[model samples]
Target: MEPFTIYEQQMQRKLTRWGIRLQKEPNLLERASKSIQNRINQVIPDKIHTTITATVKGIVQTTLFGITYMPKTDPLRGVSMADRDAKAEELLSLYKKIAAAEGAGTGAGGILLGLADFPILIGIKLKFLFELAHVYGYSTHDYRERLFILYVFQLAFSSAKKKPELLHTIKNWPAISQTFPPAADVMKQVNWLQLQQEYRDTIDFRKMLQLIPGIGAVVGAWANFGLLEELGVAGMNCYRMRNLQDKAAELADK
Candidate 1:
């Protein structure tokens, strides 16, 4: 096995700490916020709620199951971890810029354009995850692997109260993924309302600012940049955990 570089060691420590933090129960303020958010969701019209749910469901299915949406990068087979991470960093930087631009464009256009950012941003994030999977040498072509991507998304955007369970599932993904139904069945069973609610709650404050007339452009750009940055970190560490676990298992076998 290759010896861990100082950077790798530090990253491992940071990821470990993050995992611990993720497993902790939500505090009072977080619970209160979640309650408020849930109430807000309830007051939203049923038709609008259904539309959001359907949109999110469609996006998730298309992103994960679409055959034509092959990853841009080839799988990083035989690549060193350092090289893989370097490539991921480059991809993250590129996507952040793209997201910022998209946000700015929509934000400057007022409420209607601001609303359009939802699906566009979802596509960008899902595409980024697919590309990130390839960089980590994972085949996004597999249904189970794509499911892992969804789990990572959930981990990133879920409420604090929901994080522990999602984090646990992601941490034990290899086993948990096996329990999932077939792709079609899984899609049918997806809780789209929950998914959209959690996602909307997570970004509501910043995204609402993007709907404002005067400062919308700046807020949109900044919000999208930050959201992508968060996803980048989450994606990196999720793959890192899987890679490290696989390596350790291989070493144990030897």
Candidate 2:
């Protein structure tokens, strides 16, 4: 057997384990966390929530509707899923380090950088996810593909209630993507407000600690590193699911 083929088999096995975990119901601990998070959210000032939501909306709108550099996914092909993911991880690692460094610097400044701070991290995550889409051989030029990037993103940072549904959308993305026509406006189907709210609410507390003066730097680096790590896991496995399932379909027809 060829080396590439052997690596692919190993990846497929890992994908199997990832898939099982994806669909498993959230346990009691997760539910309790959600409750606590909700209580915390209720205590947060509405102004902070509004500001975060607006900032996210601005970036997300620009990223989704703005002109893109890549031509299309068809022109970009990888030798194998394993190679693609290897490249993906390389890019993800670089991004994680960059975010950590930025976090450390900003964190040292304390709450003085509070509002300005998170947007930088948010921008980093957005850039990384869009880049990760390219690594998966998807065109950032297509709105639908950008939408898919957000889906992977939400899976990483969203409340547990949203994960299973997002996972389902990812599992069925091939069909869903096919549902969109060249001129179709699918953005209406998505709740933009909800998307931003989920993202902000999820990170609000942890990121708040990143604004502290004394301990802020350490918390910032660790928090930012973990955030990217979470996104990397969610992003890679999401793409892996599509690749493995598509391969299964190919073999089934044979």
Candidate with top TM-score is 1
Candidate 2 lDDT over residue span 90-159, tens digit each: 9899999998998888888778665566778877887888877777777787788877887888888887
Model 1 Cα lDDT, one tens digit per residue, 104-211: 999999999999999899888888899999999999888898888888888899898788888888788888888988888888777888999889999988999999
Whole-structure CA lDDT of model 2: 0.77
| Segments in model 1 whose C-alpha atoms lie over 4 Å from true places | 1-7
Q: Which stretches of candidate 2 lie over 4 Å from their true place?
A: 1-4, 68-75, 181-184, 250-254
Report the Cα lDDT for residue 248, model 2.
Answer: 74
* TM-score (C-alpha, index-matched) for candidate 2: 0.87
In terms of lDDT, which candidate is strongest? 1
Error of 2 at 43 (Å): 2.8
Candidate 1, pairs of clashing residues: none
